[model samples]
Structure formats: structure tokens, C-alpha cells
Target chain A: MVKPETLHAVLNAKTVSVVGASSNPDKTGYQVLKNILDAGYQGRIYPINLKAESILDINCYPSLLDVPEDLDLVVIVVPAAAVPEVMQQAADKNARGAVIISGGFREIGNVELENEVMGIANAHDIAVIGPNCQGINYTPNKLCACWPLLTKRGGMAVIAQSGTIGATMGGWAEDEEIGFSALLALGNKSGVGEIELLDYFASDEETKVIALNIEGVKDGRAFIKTAKSALSKKPVVVLKPGRTRKGAEAAQSHTKSIAGSDKVFEAVCKQTGLIRAEGICEFYDYSKILSMLDAPLGRRMLVITSSGGSGILAADTAEDLGIELKQLSTDIKDRLKEILPNQCVVSNPLDLTGDATANRYMQALDVAITSEVIDCILVIFGDPVHKASDVVRDISSRTDKPIVVAFLGGGDVEKEEVLLMHQAGIPAFPTPERAVRAIGALLKKKNY
Target chain B: MHKLIGKALADEYHLNEAEAWELFSDYGIPTPQHQLARSVEEALDAAKRIGYPVVMKIVSRNILHKSDAGGVEVNIMDDEGLSEAYHAIIENVLAYKSDAVIDGILVCEMLKGGLECIIGMTQDASFGPTLMFGLGGIFVEVLEDVSFRVLPLSKEDALSMIYEIKASSLLQGARGQVARDVDAMAELMLKVAIMIEDNPEIKELDINPCFVFEAGGGIMPVDARVML
Candidate 1:
């Protein structure tokens, strides 16, 4: 294991040195420096460049070794040929962590230089993230240590092998208002892999859910073991692409050879208790819901929709997604009848019918949550959006039962309602299927 | 397993199907009443001792696919019939594989009408030993109806793998036919798993057409291939 202090310094470092810090805005070095400053990182920043005396008004050192103070973390944006020397110097100076955003080496059919860097990092116990990738966005200290972007502080943590994919998830989470505690781009995994980062997040107080998107791993057994341990602490939802990926071509044994990529990974995921999502929409939606609420105790779902068509659609989707549409007791159904529209009829889906108000939605939420029959609630509104902020606020502040929404309306007010629901920490979907899918994800998590 | 593998490797036989039966029997895989005879006279004597209506197959290092190579003969009722089958199998295999070195003959009681099942094991690069359970037939690959599971499996995993295939209903007694012994099959799977779990050298194992009789009638392995 890498030193705990080194990982601590890497994650919560107070002083950073951006190696090969460029003055030009077009280069990644300049952007990384600019992002750190823009993100309002309170730590000291030391930009190292051979020529530049200052970058973004911060005084620059000519070399990492030339920096007068001990460094916590170093971000290397130098050329590939120069990375080995830079890593050696960082190791010599006892730097805690280094994020090498430089490209080349293994991706370009050369691994000697990468191996050299790994040797030095291991000898010195420095936690290195990447040498051929993007960077990391740690919001706890506003450490925008990679590409310049808008990252927020919350529960979900995104860890990916691709920098672009990491950035894409970061941007998606930000767009969806899904707060994240950290966004780490695991480039090449030369020195550090997902298991370490998962270990970090497993105990991270800021992180409640982990959204992992990995194509493959160098050590699958280790990955499974670490993921299993992490699942015991917090939910680890994964999206391993390349499902059609076959095994090594030499299939001398038919039984082993026929073990397709999808089947193996599916079984591994099932065995290790990781929630493997289907698509991007499912990825973030499930991450958000799992982060905010505990998995429901059962598959029983109480879906309340304004339109009967949507109610029926949700009922069908609920069944397909493995969520049981619970039949409300007569007393609860009668109480719902008294509170709901007089023309309404109470059933499993519990249609509120057209012209239902946001007030009715909130009342139905209260009734179902109070009843012990249902494990979760799915609120779907078809049209005529009203002030849903109060409804979402009540759901968030009231009973601890998990709630998801499917706002199928299209208008300015409806968009505002969806946005409000997101802001209030309730996962609101654009369709009933997505909402049911989120609940279904919750159901799957319960199996663990 | 090491002892068996050690002896197979010493003999320079990549897979000794006859040796595989003993290993299988030691691990709870039942085999029919059988004996190995190195000559025609010994083959007839063993057949007589076992009772007539027996099966004989040419056990040779050169023959891998027995039926396709004309190395097997069944339903021999007397010494004359056994004597005839013995020379015919040797001649047929000699013509099929001119350089084939004979390793005596395997004589066993001919099984009655029963269901056929296939249980196999192979080493996976990632997950180590994995087991495949399916109905025995030539259509295993053609129909792609087999169910596989990685080893170190629980009883539930074994049973689930058995029930996962399309032929599970057939094993459960389709039409008015008697049901095949599922617990027996599950035990066989678990036994194979434990065997492979200890011996990594057994790279691939195939026991095709294991005649499974009615419920609790017990199953018997007809042929096996253990590749190291």
C-alpha cells in the first residue's frame, strides 16, 4: 500500500506545484493553473517553468526542485520525454502526489519511460494518477487539479479510466445539478488504479455513492476484492463498456474460450454486488438517487401519476423493471380518495387524473409514505405543471421514504419544476421509464 | 489430482481417458462396472465375468474421438462376438490411424435406456476453473443451449446453473418420461468443481453423454477426456 500520508497529501494537499506551467492559454498547463486559481483553491500555488517568471500573476519557479518550500502535490504537464526526469526530481524532493497530464508512452507503443516513472514513484511512494491523460477535480479543497471546469461538492464520486469520459461525467453531473465530491481521471493507471481510488471514496465522508466507468482492469481479482469491500461501506455503481469484448484469441479450451466478455463481467458484477448500469442516463440517474436515498427495503412501488395513460405505462414499466406495484389497503385507498379529486379512483398506480394540482401530488406523497405497504414512491405528472418546489421540499424534509419523479410535461413551468426537483435532491426523470428504472436500481441495490 | 496428473505426464499421455474414470470415481462420479484387458482373451474373460451384453472400446493414445475413429463397439453377447469386435476395432483404428499405438481395450457393462448429459470443466484466464452443464448430444455447440458458471460455486449456484438451461425441463421429466437425477447432477458439478479447484493442470475436462437414468437410478460416465 502507498503511504496513507502521501494519499492524504495528494487528496487534501495544501501546497501544489504545477510543473511545466505554461504561459500560453491554449496549453493544458496554463488551463490547469488557471482552473486552480479560478476554482478559488486556498492552497499555495507554485508554477514551474524554465522561461516564465510569472503565470496568471503567480510567481513561477524554474524547476520543481527550485521551489523553496516542501510540496504536497505536483501536476506535470511536460512533454513525454521530460516526464521521467520530472518524476525523478519530484521523488527526490519528497513530493506527495503527481498528476501527469502529459501524453505519449504506452499509448504510442513505448512503455519504457512509463515503467521508469512507475519505478521512481514506487521507490518514493508517490501517488501518481496519470502520465497520458486528463486530471482530477477534487471539490473538497476546490482542487481543480486537471482541466478547467465547473465541479461541485456533494456525495457522488466519478472515477473513470478516460479523461474525456471523466470530464464528460463531471460536466453531466454539473448540468444535472448532481453534486460530486471528486472527479478522478484514471489515465493509463500507470502507478495507481481504481482500487486505490475506490478505497479512498469508500471511507470518504463527502462521498455517499461511487459512479465508476471502467473499460477494463489490469488486476481483475484485486479489482473485485476491493469493489466488494467498498460495497460493504457505500454503493459502487459501475459501467464497464466493451461488453462484446472477447477473450484472448487462442481458445484451446472451448469451455474457457466461450466465456464471452459480457457473461463474465455480468457474473462478476452480480457476485461482487456492484450495480452495473445500462447507459449514461441510467448511470447518473441511479447515482443521484442512490447518493441521496437509501435503497428501498422492498420492491413494492406506489406510483402516483396525473394521467391514466402514464399511470398504466408506469405500471407496465414497474413490472418489467422488477418493481412490484403494491396494492394499497382499503383504508389507505379511501383516505387517498378523500384527499384526492372526487372523480379519482384509487388503484395500484393510483391515477390522480388530468387537472390534478401540485397540492394533490404532495398529499398523495404523504399518504403513501405514511402507509407501510409501499417501499418507494414514484410521482409522475403529465401536463399543467405548477409550483412543485413545495412538493419536492416536503418529500425531502418529511418522512424518510425514498421518492422519484417522472415529470412528462413540456413547458417553461414544467422545466422549472424538474430543475427545482433536482435542486431539492429528488431525482426527477423526463419519463416514467427512467423514474421506474431509478427505483429498479434502488431495488437491485437492496439485494446487496 | 497431482498423483493422477503426475502419472499421466510421466506416461507422456496428454490425456488418458481410462485413467480419468478412476479419478472421476474417487470424486463421487459413478462409473459402470468396467475392466481393462490388454488382449482379446482377457477382453472376453472380463466380459464373461461382468456378464454378457457388454461394450468394448479401443483405448489408444492415437484415438481422441472414439466413435468417429471407429474405436468403439457395443452389445457383444458372447466370446465369439467379443472376439470378432476386438479384432474389428483394432483393424478399423489401424486403418484410420496407421501409427496408432494400442493401449489395451476397455470392457464395461452396456447401459440400458437412459438420458444423456454433459458436464465439462475448463480453465478461464480470469476466473480460473469454470463448469458447463448441458444435455448430452452432438448439438451442444450447434444449439448453444449450455449453461456455464465459474467454479468455487455454492450449491445454489450449481442448482441455478442446472435450472438456467432450456433442457432443464427435459431433465425434469418431459412427457411421461421419468425425471433425471438433478441432485446427482448437481453433486457431479460440485465434485468436478472441487477437483479442478485443486488441480490446475487439468486444463480441460469433457465427460460427454453421461447416461443418466431415472430418479435415483444413478448416472454413469461413458467417456471422459482430461487434458493437461
Candidate 2:
């Protein structure tokens, strides 16, 4: 077992070498080399290419052995057929780490390629990342070795088995304006899998929420044991594909691995307190919420919404997700009734109607935040009087309790409101269902 | 000394089908309705009165594994089959337990259709009584799809045990088969829990092939044995 601190050091290495470095910007080798340089890593950059003299104005060596000094890390962005020789040279040169960023190995569903890659890496005692991968990114170290261009930074760390999924998640995070601590695309997982990555993230100070997109796990018992220990320190969210029989078969073909019975996985999840998401959207939704907001102290939920339709939807989604919509105390209910119209329901949802101003929204939030009956508040605001971002800013200034927001309508208001809410440490979703479901996830994480 | 061993542990060891069934009934476990006969003539008469086709097994004080010794016969559709099966069972008993007293034959009404499942209880030294549920019949050994819960189990605990087994989907209507009576299965588990709660001397009990029918038909304990 690799130590978490050692893995962190490897991820945050200052100096790195680009093996098979190319001057062609269109190729993956060139793009990754460019990303590493663009991230402004203050370290020596050694470009190792047999044919090239220089790449992007950085001097290129014929091989790692030809380099003048020791390298902290080596990134392999070459063809699959040439990987073994490059890895051998890297090992002989005593490179501290190697990231294999190429395809056509095990993930291509060929046993011959898998065995050959494994034999070479094992013989050299090299801890390789992937033969079919987009590589990895570490925000704190300003290290970016992955190809598909990511720039945002935050507290959520993503560890995905699929390279495409990891890159897509990074892209999604950037598009949603959510920052990431790290993005690791572990393709084929010839050397490292979720078990090692999870143990690595367990002690990583920068990672507040660890999200996993798993296809098939190697060791069920070991994974469960490691996950159980890690989950106590930080929340671990999993979006597992290959749940159905056909999907499991497809996953086996995809990674050359077997997906065990979903029932066993469910039992393990229950025992080890791993939060499982249904799909990609829920995965991002839950991860974003968990990254931004604190875990709910309890399951008691209070909904303060201006739109009656949105309020009803939130309440229904809450019940479906097993979140208890507790009744407010008489004092709290009376206070709400006195401020609201006669038609407004002064119950669990505490509908304030569409006529609510920013002050009214803050007052309702204040009541829910102070009440002994409510554990968390889900505030859904209708079309705002001014900009939706202003309402979000006011709400954040008013409440200390974990607040999740759902903006009702579409426009610049929705986008600006979500961004503002996130900036103020409140997670905002596009729909009431997502907001309620996120609250459910937070409650589960706290209890587990 | 052997007699002393039997006498000292008489209340703590072994029950034939009828005795086990009565004990289970006392604890609210359901079993099929039937009677016992002391002879082949009486067995035939009991089958005639109880209606055919029926199941018959040799009842002897010293013989416990009647099926293994060829003392059990099923689906005796007529008097000829019944008479032949009875004499064969008697001959089997005479050969296996020559010194033991013959305690008649048990004639039971045949239980039909539905999935076969087994519910068992064994008292572990550390865990106390651990209840188990699994697919019954010949393939049971090969397919060890079983789940266990430490007793005494609540209804929720019993349901969780059933859900724990991978083959539980088969019981819950997999591939167009009607879902077995899960409510009845839960009730059966509750009954087993109560039985173990009441009889601390029972060290082990096996109710193999607890025939579970479709919804509304209920479940029946076709065969059972107990060891104290």
C-alpha cells in the first residue's frame, strides 16, 4: 500500500519531464506539455524526444539518460508500441514518477497489450497511471499534466476510472463555475485503482469532497475497508456505472474487468457509508453541493419558497428521497402566518407566495435558521425584483445554517444567482428536485 | 451408560417430523394438516380418509434420517403403491434400526407448487442462534446463496436477511415467475424467532423445503427436524 503523503508528493512534484515531447500543437503530447507549462509550475522542464532538438522553445533531450539532471516526474505521451522502451529509459534514469498518457493498451480490450504493459511497469518498479488516460491535475501545486484543458480550482477532487468521464467532469465543473482540487483520470488502472486513490485522498488536506466515477472495482473487501476508514474523515460520493447485467458486460469489455453483483455493492455501500449517485447529473449535483455546503446536522428539513409550484415540487421530491419535512412549532408557524397572506400555507414548506421581496425572503430564512425544528433550509426564489444575484447575496449574509437554493425561472437571473450563491458558500441548483436531493445526500453523509 | 445418555438428554435431543411440526405449531409456525399411522393397514386407511396422493415416512425411535435409509416415500397415489411403500419402509427400518421400537408411519398431505426455500437455526457458541435462509433442494449445496442473521430477529431484520441473498431477486419475481409470498416468508421467520426464543434447549432446527406459494396462498413447512 502506498502512503497518502507519498502519493500527494508525487502528484505535487515541482519538476517534470515530457517524454516523447512533440512540437506539433495538434497532438496530445504537445497539448499536455503546453498545459504543464501554462499552469506556471516553477520547476525544471525536461523534454525527452528521440528526434526533436527543442519543443515550444524548451531544449529537448534524445532520451532521459541524456538529460543533465534528475527529474521529479516523467510524463509519457507517446504511441503504445513505444511505451515499454520509454518506461525502461525512465526507470534507468531514476525518474521519481511516470504518467503514461496514451491509449491502445488494456482499455482497448486486448490481453496481449495488458500483459506486456504490466510486465514492463512491474519489471521497472514504476507506478504508472494509465495506458489510455487523459492524465492528472493538481491545483495547489499548479501542476496540469492532463490534455483536455482545465483551469478552475477549488476543494472537490474527482477520481474516475474513465478518462473521458474525468475530462468531461472537469469540463462540467469549469462550465458550472465550480473549482476543483484535483482531477485524476485512471484509465485501465493497470497500476492504480480506486482503492489507492481513495486512500490517497483520505489524508489530502486540499480535498474536502472526493467524487468517484467507478466502472468496476478490483478488490471488493479491500475497497470496502479503505472506503470505510476514509469516509469517517471526508465524504466519499460514488457514481457507479455497470449496475445492470448488460451494462456490467459492457463495463467488462470496456476495462477488461468484471463488475460484481450490484446487490453486493449496495450491501457494501450500506456497511461502509459510501454515498452512491444515480447518474452523471446527480453525481455533479451532489458533488457541487457537498463541496460548497456543510453536512446537515440532522434530517429535519424546512422549505421556504416564494413559488407555490416550486414549493410543492420540493416537498414532493423531499418525501421521495426520504427527507422528513417536519412541521413547524406554533410560535414559528404563527410568526409566518402573521407576515404572509391568508392563502399562504404556514406548514413545512412555509410558502411565502410570489409577492416575496428580498427582505421577506431573508426574514423567512432567518425564521427557519433559528427554529429548533429545522435542521436545514431549502430556499427557492421566484423571478427576483432586481437581479437574482442580489437576493442570493442577501440570503448568504443573513443565515449561518446550510442553505441550498433553487432558482425557479430561466434567464441571466438563474445563472447569475447560482454563481453568486456558490460564491457566498451556498450551493444552488437549477431545479427544486436537485436542491432537495442534495440536501438528502448531505443528511446521509452526516449520519453515515 | 448409553441409556443414561439418552435419558439425561432426552429433552435436549432430536424430534421426528410430527413432533417437530407440533412444536412449530405451538410457536405459530404453519405446517400441513395430517395424521400418524402405526401400521401399513392404518397408513392406507389414513391416506384414504385424508385423501390422496399423500407422503409417508417410517417412524422409529432410533432412526432419524429416514430418507437416507429409504424409509421415506412420496406420491403414493393408490392403495397398491401405499401398501408396497409401507412394507418397503418397514423393511428399511427393520434393517437400519433393528433394536429400536417402531413408532408407526407419518402420513402427510402432499404440499404442491411454489419455490422451495429452507429456513434453519443453529446455536453458535459465540453468536447464539443464527437463523439462515437459502434456496432448498439438490442444488442448495452447489449454490450456496444463503444469508444469515443472529436471532431473535424482528420482522425488519428478517426482511433484511431475505434481501441480503443474491438470489433474492428470483424470489421477488425474476424472469416472469410470480413473486413468492414474501410476507408469509417474513411471518415464517418471525415464528422461527419465537420458537428459538421459547425453547433454549433446541440447539439446532432445519425446516428444509419450506414451500412458498404465490401471493395469498401462503407458505407451508413440508418437512422439519429439531435437535436440542
At residue A392, candidate 1 shows an lDDT of 67
RMSD of 2: 10.2
Candidate 2's C-alpha runs over 4 A off are A1-6, A109-113, A341-345, A385-400, B1-228
**How many pairs of residues collide in each model?**
0, 1
Q: Over the stretch B1-228, how does candidate 1's per-residue lDDT look in tens digits? A: 568888887887766667788787777778778888999889978998899999998888878888888989999989999999999999999999999999988998998877888888876555666788888775377786877777677787788877878878888888877788888778777888888887878889998878877889767777788888
Candidate DockQ values, in order, are 0.26, 0.06
Docking class of 1: acceptable
Model 1: lDDT of residue B92:
91
> What residue pairs clash in candidate 1, if any at all?
none
Error of 2 at B165 (Å): 11
Each model's TM-score? 0.90, 0.72
TM-score of 2: 0.72
**Candidate 1, residue A246: lDDT:** 42
lDDT of 2 by residue, A1-448 (tens): 4445546656878668998788888888888889988977778888887888889889999888888876667899888888777777777776656788878776655658667766766765566777687798888887889967787888789998877777777788877788888899888787767888898887788888899998876766577678878898888999888889898889878877666666556545665678899888888888888877777777778888878899889989999988888998898878877776687778878787777777777666656667887778888876653455565566667665677888867467677667766776777788899899888888766632
Please give the CA lDDT of all the candidate structures: 0.80, 0.78
The residue pairs that clash in candidate 2, if any, are: A154-A180
